[model samples]
Target: MAKKVVTIKNLEYEYPDGTSALKGINLDIFEGESVALIGLNGAGKSTLLLHLNGILQSDEGDVEVLGMKVAENIREIRGKVGVVFQDPDDQLFMPTVFDDVAFGPINMGFSEEKVKEKVRMALERVNMSGHEKRAPHHMSLGEKKRVSIATVLSMEPEILILDEPTSNVDPRARRNLIELLNGLDITKIMATHDLELVSETCDRAIVMFEGKIAANGDVEEVLTDSKLLESHGLEAPVLVRLFRDVMNREYIPIRLEDVIEKPNKYKI
Candidate 1:
């Protein structure tokens, strides 16, 4: 059986102003799973993510990372779960890419030589090799996003958490980012409105609505449910809509490759 890297049970949280963000949430994320948290604005997706690494303490329940309680093992948990924020600029504050990537390892007490090696491997994983000296502020948005990922990668976390990872990138950048995400083997959890990205890279889909889990199932099953998606302010992927609505076919294709594999099967 796969290991459960993250486990949340009856989780609840409220903002300082008494705005409830998460309510009675329960979830288990297993090792090597790529899960997508999909929800409309104010639906508690980000709030739930904050609890994963101890960024926010739960008000009413338990959150465990790799068998340790988040509330009591914050420092240790932080080292194993890396979070990449929605905005790359929020993560890349150092003057150069090298500094940003090396910050985590340096703080973790790695030697200078080890930090350099970590930074190099992390950057290479993100395809950002040989640009260490470049200032983050001067790089393109896509490059900055890669650097932001490298910052967390340098830590060698067991799980990777991302928020709106493809939020502001162009088509080429988005494609590259998708490829990079698919290549990673660690457990991943991402909160994103990009259904297309979910269709391509995620194994499971979780729909969050009003601080509760509305749906949790395989990516294809969840994405094919147009009514379920529509009720929660989400739309099915373009291919799903095309095959189910326009083409009037009962079979839904969530990814482009599905259609490409059997064009005649989906023909009108």
Candidate 2:
């Protein structure tokens, strides 16, 4: 049987001024599943990601990540849930890339030697090797993004949570980021506005609208539902819409590899 990684029930949040952010969100994320959280701005996607890592305490409801409740075990939960914030500038605060990537592991009290090793591995994993000596401000947007992921990866968390992983990246960099995410075998939940990235990197998707979950299902189902996507200020990818024109709805493929590997060839 599959292990239940995170369970959220009646999850709710509000700002100090009583502005509601998340409203009674209920979700279950299984181990090793790659899921996408899609929503328009002010839809509470970032707010929800903060809650998963215990960075933001909610006004109501319970959140359990990796079998541990977030509120009571915040310290432990933060160590297990690695959150990569939307803005690389906000996330990578250390002057040097090495310091930023080593912060998390060091915070967990890893020995200097072990932390060094971990940071090296993390940067290599994100293909940001040899950037350790560079200043965060000196790197390009794409380079900064990878370094930010390295920061979280060095901690070796069980669940990986990211907000707007591709927000300001160029087309080539965006594709590279998607490929890097696809290669990771960890349990990942990404909060993104890029439907194409979601379609390519995630198997399941959850849509948030105005502090509530709008829809949740297989990537293809949620992404291809023209009315649903339109309602949430989104549209299906070009590949998705093109495939839908010819393929049976029951077998709408989401991954690029699926379309390329299949024997039945239809030019889109």
Off by over 4 Å in 2: 245-252, 263-268
Candidate 1: stretches off by over 4 Å = 264-268
Each prediction's whole-model lDDT (CA): 0.94, 0.88
Report how far residue 155 has shifted in candidate 1, in Å. 0.4
Best by lDDT: 1
Please give the range of 10 consecutive residues that has the lowest summed lDDT in model 1: 259-268
Candidate 2, residues 1-268: lDDT per residue as tens digits?
7899999999989898989999999999999999999989999998988888888987589899988888899889888889888889999888899999999888889999999999999999999888888999988899888888889889988899999999989998898898889888899999999998998899899999999999999887898798899889988887777667655444566667777797365443
TM-score of each: 0.98, 0.94
**Across residues 188-209, which tens digit of lDDT does each residue of candidate 1 receive?**
9999999999999999999999
Give the Cα error of residue 142 in candidate 1, in Å. Answer: 0.8
lDDT of 1 at 2: 95
